[model samples]
Target chain A: MAFPPFAVTVDLVVFTIRDDQLCVLTIERGEAPFAGGQALPGGFVLPDEDLADAAARELAEETGVGKDAELERVHLEQLGTYGDPTRDPRMRTVSVAYLAFAAQLSEPIAGTDAAAAQWMPVASALTTSLAFDHGQILADGLERARAKLEYTTLAATFCRDEFTIADLRHVYELVWDVTIDPRNFHRKVLASEGFVEPTGEQTSQGRGRPAQLFTRGDATQLHPPIRR
Target chain B: MAFPPFAVTVDLVVFTIRDDQLCVLTIERGEAPFAGGQALPGGFVLPDEDLADAAARELAEETGVGKDAELERVHLEQLGTYGDPTRDPRMRTVSVAYLAFAAQLSEPIAGTDAAAAQWMPVASALTTSLAFDHGQILADGLERARAKLEYTTLAATFCRDEFTIADLRHVYELVWDVTIDPRNFHRKVLASEGFVEPTGEQTSQGRGRPAQLFTRGDATQLHPPIRR
Candidate 1:
């Protein structure tokens, strides 16, 4: 019966595999709450927009990603909600955090009054100071990404449309931050039915033998997870 | 700088195993916006409460689980946030759904103006009508519970403090809605270190044998998940 004294926002932990490193898109907030501090790209959800739509809009606004490009190339899902009563200094703000992944990204052009926008490696981002509870949100999102890779075909989302087994393996290594056995990794990935299918064409990466290319298959849940 | 136009609420999907079936707690709404419809036990979150605290509070209020007992025995986690703009007829509301599990539970007593509250078999509840986006939330919660059993020792949360391997298997069978081989189930559960530990006691069920009792262990995740 009383007016709800709370606010809803959407924050995105937009991740990408770039140059053999796992990076997330972050912006330097231009507002009073931790102004000039790095934070996940996000803003308040509009009254009429869906949660996912708000996240996608904020992602485009902060990263300058074209709407079409974002819709076609990015994968987003609800991560979790954070409402700690005092999470926001201005009001009781409950943020629905989203986990997103994209293959490749260019330098960001800051929008929506963000002082700066750029891609920061997950490792460094974890160490850098962030606004509000964005630090914990980033940590949770990274763990989700790592755990998802073990049992889901999401790793392929971080690679080019046409990539080799090595390319897929690198995504795991970068995200998990571990050196997996190449032979074992190759064998398991190929054996996992509907995980990846060969393109029948091989591309030489250097002087060595040309590695066969493959694309993501239809499988969503891996039966035998690729353990870390 | 504008006031956030969204209202925040919490919905709980509390699951329990009873009579060889997985049941979820549901309450009949006592007010408009689908009044008298069966729904997951939930209400508007109070302003000063944390999200999880709000879920815990609502769980206790609607189900009559004592605060201390609920805090100790229940395992709760953020399932996901549902914000479809039109989910609530009153205004723009974003409900943070929570997934919870309890060992053995008694009949629920409706509280806080709920018309009635009771535990209903998940299968039957799925077919029955529910208020708001609760049906979708229930589906997601059920899938999460089923998947969690594969890798986490969460099934133990559905058993008594000290239970037999057969009792544990029944929890799996009931939640997954699939019968598992007794021998294979026992072997896999024990072999998975940190899944359960002997309690140095035994209990007799019906006219069968006296089975050894075991308690949940420290291990959170199984290396090789028990496949369904």
Candidate 2:
């Protein structure tokens, strides 16, 4: 029996927020087809692993989300597939792109086929040419993150487990790149049931009086979504 | 140099509303692996076509949405990828699933390898055994449709170009399997800016009175989403 002439690859658009800016994990390709250019950290799927497993494995190898991985702290989801026949010059390849978000990450460790890895600010990365169709994948990942914040508790993934309302608002401000009315943001978040629950503790981190700490609630979809 | 060991396929979960229920297009497989069983209308990606192009072609072939295709009227989007190495019995295959919605689609015409094609209510299709991992794909598609209704102008796709408030509410009720308060639904939908625009026409379709006509608006994402 003749096998279908095709190849499957997994790409990760890992996102993080550092220095009040949204950043994406990128690697310098050590091989041809845009060699030395920055690209999302990813690789071909193994015959024995699931697509998501391949994505996580590639993420671990490219970044350092290794064995001690606080997997739950990371929000990982399938972004979409990019399968333009001419996307890869060598062969007909279909790539399954994944979206991952977590708290600020340290520098990444390059894989065998990567020259180096680092977290690039989303703004700077969008202007640079990325390998293959990775630029499109990064754009889609960023949009997904922005949209998800409206209806899902995904924003919490970018913060520590215990955070104040201001800490959460900063996540929104940084990702959306807008300064929101702190009082309005706090009111909306508190009114949206299952969005967050007060921890009965306060944090004296930023200016003004200490703010109450809170954790993500049980709700996945917010009833009245916080509009962007 | 070695090629990646995998085949790429596209599976479409085409949905529509008919007889007050959400329906899915399904085909009976005429080939082995799961012969005589029902499956989503799809096939392996052709070497020369883009992933989405291949999906649209397969859709046209299996359901006769051919050339003069009302492609613009249909809302088609990539759902996600399913690649459990063992999901396919023949070889390691990665399948990209797509979700398509249109005004009530006619009975499907079977393609070369399908024995028959029919529009099955999503409720019934969920309980029936489908070939491969198609059952899971259908479920995901249904959920995507349900969720998209909350934050997008997608509900308009289910109605005719000019429709009444009752017609729009029915689409939501059918997909969500809930009875929404007609008064509240009308107020909420109208309150959301750019959700639907009045067309200066009325139709007495079902009963009672001739309702005002409206068409889909310019907005894609609803600012203050009409939450379910």
Candidate 3:
């Protein structure tokens, strides 16, 4: 029987804020299909599992990060797939790309089958030595994250459940890397009906100004659209 | 050297508007992977080609209706890749799902896979006895198209260059199957900077009220987001 000539790989373009800049988690490959090259952290998907579950499993497996983390939990979503026939050297391989967003991290532990794993600044990651179409995947993921922040309360997903308006603003500022007018930002968030609700609490985060703490609003959409 | 156990296939979730309902192009598989069964129009991706290009090419090769019928003018985009090990009975196959949006069509054609190619309403396509994760892919494509209509002039991508405002409005109404207030739609569309521009023209649609002609706008962002 002629063996089927296809393969499946999972590539993760995990983004996080590091040193006030958007960064991507990537690794130097250790074997063929792209050995000794920088690429997104991923591997062959196993049998008997859903795609999203596999992605989460891979993320934790590689990082050795527990199910829970200190930072506002990272969010993961399916990005577009890439399957240029020649994307891999061994054979025709299709890759499902997933986008992940984590809070600002001190450092990411690059996991197994990788020479090393580290957070590379997105600007630098934009043009890279990524093995396959991962550079494109990384760009796609970052664009998705930026666009998502505009219409959904997703930016808050990158921050803790309890946050000051200032904390919420930082998610936008870091993800978009643009300064948002605080007065305008505050008015916009509060006005978004279910965007953020006052928790009847406050945080002394600024050392002087007692900022009011709020939780994510019940509504899923951001009306009047938060300018990304 | 041991060969990499990977396979690549391209599955098309071809969509069209028929009888004012969303539909997809499908084929009856007569070969092994899913022998004698109904499935999306797809096959093994060949070596030395881009996946998206391959998908579009396959649609044309199978239907003999490329770049002509609005319902066949493949506007293909990657949906997502499925790479679970047990997805294929023979070996590990990574299917890169592609989404295609064609305008309304008159008739269907044969698929390249030596089976009947036909158009079925999106609702019925759901009860598919297809192979792999095609069901999930179809759902994702529909959701993406629905969400995309809110922002980009991507809906225009489903139609020809010069179409009437009523035609455009109908696209939204038909795709979402929701009645959009024509006047409000026109107003909201006109308000969005790059949504629709005055074509300084009209269409003699051979009926009452010759619709006003307009083209896609320049701004990419939908200013004053369109509400669903």
Per-model TM against the reference = 0.96, 0.92, 0.85
DockQ (CA atoms), all models = 0.78, 0.73, 0.52
Per-residue lDDT for B59 in model 3? Answer: 77
Instruction: Check candidate 3 and list the clashing pairs.
Output: A6-B6, A6-B7, A6-B8, A7-B6, A7-B7
| Full-model lDDT for every candidate | 0.87, 0.86, 0.75
In candidate 3, how many Å is residue B41 off? 1.3
lDDT (Cα, 0-100) at A82 in candidate 3: 77
Question: How would you encode candidate 2's per-residue C-alpha lDDT over A1-228 as one tens digit per residue?
Answer: 465667788899988888778889889888898987899888888878999999888877876675585677788899999999899998888889999988876554657677888888999999999999999999999888898997788888898889888888999998888899999998999998988899999988767899999998998887777878
Error of 3 at A183 (Å): 2.2
Summarize candidate 1's per-residue lDDT along B1-228 as a digit string, tens digits: 676667788899999987778999898888898988899988788878898988888988877675565567678999999999899888888899999999776665657877888889999999998999999999999999999998898999898788999999999899998889999888898899999999899887688788889999999888678878
Number of clashing pairs per prediction, in order:
0, 0, 5
Who is ahead in lDDT, 1 or 2? Answer: 1
User: Which regions of candidate 1 are displaced past 4 Å?
Assistant: none
Clashing pairs in 1: none
- Alpha carbon deviation, residue B7, candidate 2 (Å): 1.3
- For model 1, residues A1-228, the per-residue Cα lDDT tens digits are 675667888899999987678999888887788987889988888879999998888888876665575566567888999999899999889998999988886654567767778888999999998899999999999999999998899898888778899999999999999998989999999999988988998998798888999988989889788888
TM-score of chain B of each: 0.95, 0.94, 0.86
Q: Which digits, one per residue and each the tens of the lDDT, describe model 2 over residues B135-214?
A: 99999998899989987989998887788889899999999999999999999889878889999998976769899999
**Model 3 chain B worst lDDT run, 10 consecutive residues:** B65-74
Stronger candidate by TM-score (2 vs 3): 2
Model 3 lDDT, residue A166, Cα:
87
